[model samples]
Every structure is written in C-alpha cells, then in structure tokens.
Target: MGFQKRPYEPTLFVKIGENGKMLIACLYVDDLIFMGNNKGMFSYFKRSMMNEFKMSDLGRIHYFLGLEVVQSNDGIFVSQKKYAREILNRFKMQHFNPTNIPVEFGLKLTKAGRGKKTDSTFYKQIVGSLMYLTSTILDIMYAISLVSGYMECPTAMHLLAAKRILRYLQETKDFRIFYEKGEKADLIGFTDCDYAEDQDSIKSTSGYVFMLGTGAVSWSSKKQTIVTLSSTEAEFVAATACAC
Candidate 1:
C-alpha cells in the first residue's frame, strides 16, 4: 500500500513494508507484472487488486510482449521462438538455409555498393520487423542494425543481408537467455567498437551490452558520431557511451 512510482522508470512502482518485505509492480498500458520476494505480501497485493478491479490473473508470466518464459528449478529462460518463426515466414525466408552467423565475419557494407535497388517498402517492412525481434534476440541486433542503416535506399545486397539475419533467426529460434536463480544480479556491461568500419563515411560503430546475472537486460549497436582516428580512441568513445 505504500508503493511509490519508481523515479527513473515511470511505469514501475515499489514499496517496502514494515516487515522489510519488498514488492514491485510494473504497468504497461493495460498489462501489469507483479514481482516480490515475500509470498504473503504478494498474495495480499493480488487480493487487493482483485477486490478493486475487473482483471484476470494469468497466473505466472509465461508470455509477455512476444517473449516466452519457461520456469524451472534451475531458473527462468526467456525467448521468442514463435515471434522469430512468424517474422521469418512473413518475409518469406522460412525456407532459406540457416547460417551459423548472422553476418559473415569481416563483411563490410556501404551505401555506395553497386547493386540493383530493392523495393523500398518491402525492405523497410522487413527491417522494422527484424528490429522488433531484436528485443529478445540479441544475436541479430548488430546484423539488423547494419542492414537497417540502408533502409532509406536499400539495395539488392542489403535485402539479401537482412534475409540472412532472418535465416539465422530461423535456425536459432529456440535460443533462450537463462536467468539462473540465486545468481548475482549485479549489473555488468561490455563495450567495443570498430575503427572506421562504415565504408561510406569512414565512421566507427560503437556497441554495448548490459547484463543482469547471465542474461542481457539492455544492449545497443550504433554508429559513432565523430570520426575516430585510432582504434584506441574508438574504444574510448565506446566505453564512454556505455558508462552513460
């Protein structure tokens, strides 16, 4: 009952009771997720909600926003197998051969690549869908973001690359991020960058991934704003960005 809205995350609310039990609730549109370490408090909170609102208790969170959660004695595993399959089929890449890697190593793409222009509308649709899929599928984040750079004027080569990501998704659709119970939830992050990887502008790309326990909670792959003269400088830029 003493729950207050979280300062940083707007939709999250938290409360600490006299017994030192902690409870949290996250609201997104009409959906709500409740989490707490105290079972008695959780039951009290659930009862209060049922008394005040017309809502259905879906039991434990198995699926949310396309993420499938599998609970076990080991811990929890989250994935998007259904969503990955849907997107692969939507883009007509379900039958394509899967690859071990989403993008070929040392592959560099540019806006000036010589190739036939692809259907802008269809290319954008595929890119957008793949971008959404990256929420639970971090392996394809870099590849998706790379191909997305050319969404404004995608070419045949760019489309092919995007489909390759879908193929990777098709192959690894069952991949899950396991959040082992009792594991330290300390936030750990890693950052790296390539010096002048973008061939067109010769600008570097910076990337970072933050994890809680063993599973990633946030990640990003973006182009650096200024030209970095050396790999050392590029790494510095990436580390600074991740620190932020």
Candidate 2:
C-alpha cells in the first residue's frame, strides 16, 4: 500500500527501503506483476491485493505478454520462441529455406528497382510483424528497419529483402535472452554508424546496444534524420542519438 507510482512509467509502482528491501509492481489493464527480494513484503502485499481485488495467485511467472519466461538457479531467460514460429507460419514461411544472414553484406537498396511492383499493404504487414519480433530478436532489427522505409511503394525486390529476414528467423527462432546470475553486471554499450549508406536518402543508419551482464537491456537501430557531411559527423550524430 505504500508503493509510490513511478513518475516516468505511469503503470509502474515501487516500494523502496533503506535496508536493501524493495518491491515493484506493474499494472497492465487487469494484469499485475510484482516482484521483490523480501519475502515478508511479498506476503503482505499479496494478502492486501486479495482483500481489495479479486485476483488469482499465479505463482512464479512463466509468461508475460508475448515473452516466454524461463527461470532457473542460474538466473532468468526470456524469449519469443513461440511467437517467432507463429510469425513464420502466419506468413506461410514455416518451410521456407533458411538463410544464414538476414541481409546481404554491403548491399545497397533504393526505391528505384527493376523488379515488378508488389502489394504495398502486404509488404507493410511483413514489416510490422518483424518489428514486433525485434522485441526479443535484435539481430533482425536493422534489416526490418531497412525494409520499413519502402512501405509506400514496395517492389518485388523490397518484398524479397523483407522475406530474407523471415528465412533467417526460421533457423534462429530458438534464440533467447539469458540473464545469468553471479556475474558483475556492468552496463556496457556499443554503437556504430554507416556513412551515407542509403542510396535514395543518403542517410546513415545509427545502431547501438547496451548490455547488463549476460543480456542486452537497451538497444536501437534507426536511420538518422539529417544527412551528415562526413563519416566523422555521422558518427557524432549517431553517438548523440545513442546517448539520448
């Protein structure tokens, strides 16, 4: 009951203590998830919630939203393995031949293509689906973002490129993020940018990843807004974006 609502995250509430005791609760519509290191606090909070609201104790979390949660003595592992497979089946790519990589190395793509025009709506649907997968699949983020820019008039080549990501996913859908225990959880980050790689817009893509211990906690892959004059400028812009 003493939990304070987080200012930035409206759905999150926290109970902090000076003796290293803490509790956090998140409310998503009718769903609520709470976790803490103190058993006494957890017991008290569970009783209070049951008194005020009709709720079921689900015990340990096994799944949340579209994420699969697997816990062990080592730590926690999260992924969307089921969702990934569903994506492949939904697009009728469940049996498609797998690819080692999502995109070709150093491949330059533009709106101008000799391939026949494809269904823009279908193309956008693929992009949107892959975008959701990026929540647990960071490897495909850049490729998905690249194909997303051509949603207005996607050609056959653009569709092929988008499906290439699916083929890659077909083989790597079992990938999961593991947050192992007993490791020094240093917040490490890495960033990179390609100088004027986009042929149509001449814009550089900025990508960054921030990791905590064994798994990544923060990351992004986005196209820069401004056209930088040089590689140095592009790097500066990318670094600024990553920092912000």
Candidate 3:
C-alpha cells in the first residue's frame, strides 16, 4: 500500500453473473494473490486483463513477496534461501561459524551498559539487514524481534546477539516450507504475548501466526501501545490485536 493518504479512488472492479462464479484477487501494490475453483475462468480473466493492459506472463507463480515457490507433482514448496544467503553475504556473515539456535532461550536482553559505543553503526546495520531478511524468513522472527530492542542505542552484547541470529541463519540456510498435495487446506492460528517483556519501557510484546495447510500465510509481532492493568488485560489486548 502507498504511504500517502488521498481521497478514495477505485482502480479495479469485479462483477459476477448470477449463474457464474468469479475469482477473488487481492492486490497490495505489486504483490497479488488469486483464488478460484475453475481453471478456465482464471484463464479467461487473465486474458481479459492482458487485453486491457500490457503485461508479461511470468509462467506459473513460483516466487512472490521475496518467497520462492517450487511446484512439483507432489505439491508446492516455498523458501527464502536466496534472500537469506544474500543477507548473510551482504553483512559478511556467510563465512562465520553456524549456530544451532537463533538466540539463547530465556536470555534477557536489557538496554544498559551492555554495548560499546564504537560498534553502534555495525549493530544498526546488522539489525536492519535482519529485519529485511525476516520479511520472508519466519523462523528468524523471534530472534530479530529480540535484537530489535537495542536499536535505539546498541551495546556489544546486543551486537553479539544479532550476530548469533546471523550465524543461526548460516546453519539453516536451506530450510523451507513445503505444502504437500495430499494435505488438507485448513486455516489455524496461534497467539502469544510476553508481559512487560521490554525491560526499559515495561511494555509487553504480542505475536501471532496464522497457517494455511502446512505454510505460514500471515503473521505479526508488535509491542503494546498502552499499559495494561493486569496480566489478564494484557493477554486480552494481545488476543484482540492478533484477531484484528
């Protein structure tokens, strides 16, 4: 979506006949997702669109939104291996030793005298790269979220934590999400929150992920904007945010 705000204007429209069904196509800037039951109908729709505007057919949808998709007789597979490797090489992390985990579990990262002033730029650069990488690499979500806390004024400890995430990526560079042909098409979701997780602001962080079949289709992680009176309230708010 464009960042600028303007009056409403309709650029695309759809209509369906009473006896005929129409496919639903959702577009966000250049990214699009199309759903339809009839292959013939989709083909007709594509032809009409092509007649109206000049477009190039990229052949079957193999990649979109930084995610690489591979379709086989068995099913479809999605991965960001190329994007991950690019990030690693861009930050000069590809040659480093790989780690088993993105971050140490139960590790509390606090903003204090934990980092050195000389490495502030390096820390920011790493975090920014990781943030870009996380757009398609959901497995790195938690680690990137944790390391992002120190962006304001990073320390040596924070830099180490961010580097650990990169190292973890180095180890799991080939991982991908596979959607098999026989798997049922189902939508499921999970929500979680860490109360007062941020030591400095005492603000809780809420996260949720929604899966379709075997792949994560949507997910988010955000800090609570308002303080909650109790744990229950915090949980309720986080759930509401997740639902929305």
Best by TM-score: 2
Candidate 1 lDDT tens digits, 99-216: 8899977888889655999898999998888888888888787887688889888888888888888878878988999888988799999898888988888889889999998899
In angstroms, give how far residue 219 of model 1 lies from its true place.
Answer: 1.9
**1-244: candidate 3 lDDT, tens digit per residue:** 1122223424333445346665656556765555555777778767877898776767677777777888899888888888889989988999999998888887788888464643667788888877876655786787888888778788778888888999999998888877778888799999888888777788888888988888887787777898876788889988999888
- Measured on C-alpha atoms, candidate 3 has an lDDT of 0.77
Clashes of 2: 0
Q: Model 3 Cα RMSD, Å? A: 4.5
Candidate 2 lDDT by residue in tens digits, 135-221? 888888789879898999988888889999999999899999999988999999999999999999999999999999999988889
- With a 3 Å backbone cut-off (N, CA, C), the pairs that clash in candidate 2 are none
Write down the TM-score of every candidate: 0.93, 0.95, 0.81
What TM-score does candidate 2 get on C-alpha atoms?
0.95
lDDT, residue 177, model 2: 92
lDDT leaderboard ranking: 2, 1, 3
Best lDDT among the predictions, by candidate number:
2
Global local distance difference test of model 1: 0.88
